[model samples]
Target: VNIDYLKKHADELKRVAASVLTGTVTASLLINKLQSYPRQNNLMYVLQSYGQLVKTIFICKYLLQLPLRHRINTQLNKGEQLHNLRVYLWFGGDGIIRKKQEKQQQVTARCLNLLTNIVMVWNTVYIQEILKQLQKEGYQVDEKDLEHISPAPFEHINRLGKYDFNDEIRLQENGLRALRPPVDKR
Candidate 1:
C-alpha cells in the first residue's frame, strides 16, 4: 500500500484502466508481457497499490455501515448455503472432482450447477405454495419475512438414492408434491 507510488502513477493507472475498458489493451496480456521481463514493472506496482487502496476503502465502508454489513453478511450466508448444497449433492466421488480432463471437469461442474438450480426451484415452488396456503387461511404473511426466506434448505430432499425421472411428472399442472399443512404454533 504505497500511497506515494499510487499518487505518482495515478495518470498511468487511469490510462491503463481506460485502455482495458476500451478493449484497446488486455490487462492479462500486459501483465504476462511485463512478467516476462527481468526488470521491475512500475505500472504493475501501481496497480497493486491501487488494488490495496480500493480494498482498504471497502473495509472502512464495511466497518462503518450497518445496512451494508447486514446485506454483505446475508449474501455471504447465501453463498455458503449454496456451497453446502453443492457439497451435499456432490456425494459421488466423495465430493471430489475425479475427472482429470478440463472438459470433463467442466461438465461435472455444470451438471452439479444444474442439480443445485433444480433443487432451489423445487424448494421455492413448495415454499411459495405453502405461503399461499397460509395466506388463504388468514395468516399474516410479511414481505420482510419473505425476503429472509431462502431456497437453500435441502433437509427434506432425498439426495442419497437414485431418482426415477422417467415416470416423474413435470412441474406443470399439479406436478409438485402436495404442501404439508401448516401447524398452528400459537
Candidate 2:
C-alpha cells in the first residue's frame, strides 16, 4: 500500500467517494471506466493502494483478535448450515437447477429462498415454544443456550412432498402441533 500516494491524492479520493455516495456516479460504472483506461489512471492506482491498506489492516486485526475470529467462524458455520439445508430441500432434479434462462434461474433462486425462509420461520416458532415450555417446567433455560440454536435444522422436516391434512395433526389451541416432551438425557 502506497501511503504517500494516497495522501497526495486525498482530495481526488474524497471527490470520487462523494460522487459515489451522492449517487452522481455508480461504483460499477467507475470501475468499468477505470479498467477501460489505456494507461494506468492515477486515481485508480491510489484507490487500489487504499483497498490493499484496508485489507491488510483487517487481516492483522483478524489474526490478533480472538473474539473476532470466533465470531467470523460461527457466522461462517451458520451460513454453511443454511446452505446444507438448501441442498437438502433441493431434492427435485437431483439438486441441480435445470433452468436455462437467466430469468427462470432467478425465479428458481427466489423460490428456494422463500422456501428456506418459511422453514426458518417454522423452526424459530417451534424453538421459541419449546424454550417457553422448558422454562415453565422449571428448567434453567439460558440465553446463552438459545444463542447456539439455529433455525436451519431440517431433520424433522419431510421433503418428499408428503401431505397429511388430518385434523389430528393440529392438536394445540394455537393451531400448531403440540410441543414434544423433552427426552431424558440418561
Candidate 3:
C-alpha cells in the first residue's frame, strides 16, 4: 500500500519482468522449431515449460502495467496461469495420444500454436460480429466509396518510370478513371 515502497521495488520488478520476457520469447522460438515435426511425449514437457514461461511473462507484464499502490488480483493471476497450463497440458501436450485412444486424433505442436489458433478463431468471430453490428447500425461497405483514395503524391512520383515522369502522370490519371463507377449503369 505504500507508494514509496512500490517505487523502490519498481526497478527490481522491471529487471525480473525483462528476464521473464526473454525466457518466454526464447522458449517460444524453440517450440516453433519443435512443432515442425510429429508430436511426441518428450516434446510435451518442453512445451509445458515454455507455456509456464509465457504465463510468467504475461503475469509480470500485467502486474507492471497496474498502477502503483494497487494490489494485484491473486485469483485472476492464478486463473490466467491455470488456464494457460490447462491449455498446455490438454491441447498442446500428450493429448494427441489420448485423443487417439478415444478413436479421434488431432495434433497440435505447442502451447503457442494452440493459443494462436484460439486467438485467430476468436478474432474472426469477433470481427464478423462487429461487422454485423455495424450493418445493423446502418453502416455499409462500398467498393466505389474507396475510389477517391489514392497513393500519396510522393509515392506516385516515386513509382514513375526511370525516365518517363509524363507517362506516370498519364498512368495515374487512367488508373483513377478506371477506379471510378461506370457511367452507363443500367
TM-score for candidate 2, please give it: 0.83
Q: Candidate 2 — which residues are off by over 4 angstroms?
A: 134-147, 171-175
Whose lDDT is greatest here? 2
lDDT of 3 at 171: 32
What does candidate 1 score in Cα RMSD to the true structure?
A: 3.7
Question: For candidate 1, which ten residues in a row score worst on lDDT?
Answer: 168-177
Candidate 1 displacement at residue 111 in angstroms: 2.4
Per-residue lDDT for 1-186 in model 1, tens only?
A: 778888888899889889889998898987887689788678777877898999999999999999999888887888888889988888889888999999999999999999999999988888988888889989999986775678988787787678777866545466776666657999
Give the per-residue lDDT of model 2 (tens digit) for 20-106: 999999999999999999998898888999999999999999999998998788888889989999998888887778989999999
Residue 25 C-alpha lDDT in model 1: 80
Clashing pairs in 1: none
Name the regions of candidate 1 deviating beyond 4 angstroms.
Answer: 99-103, 127-147, 161-178, 184-186
lDDT agreement of model 2 with the native: 0.89
Q: How close is candidate 1 to the true structure, as a TM-score?
A: 0.73
| TM-score between model 3 and native | 0.20
Q: Considering TM-score, where higher is better, how would the candidates rank from best to worst?
A: 2, 1, 3
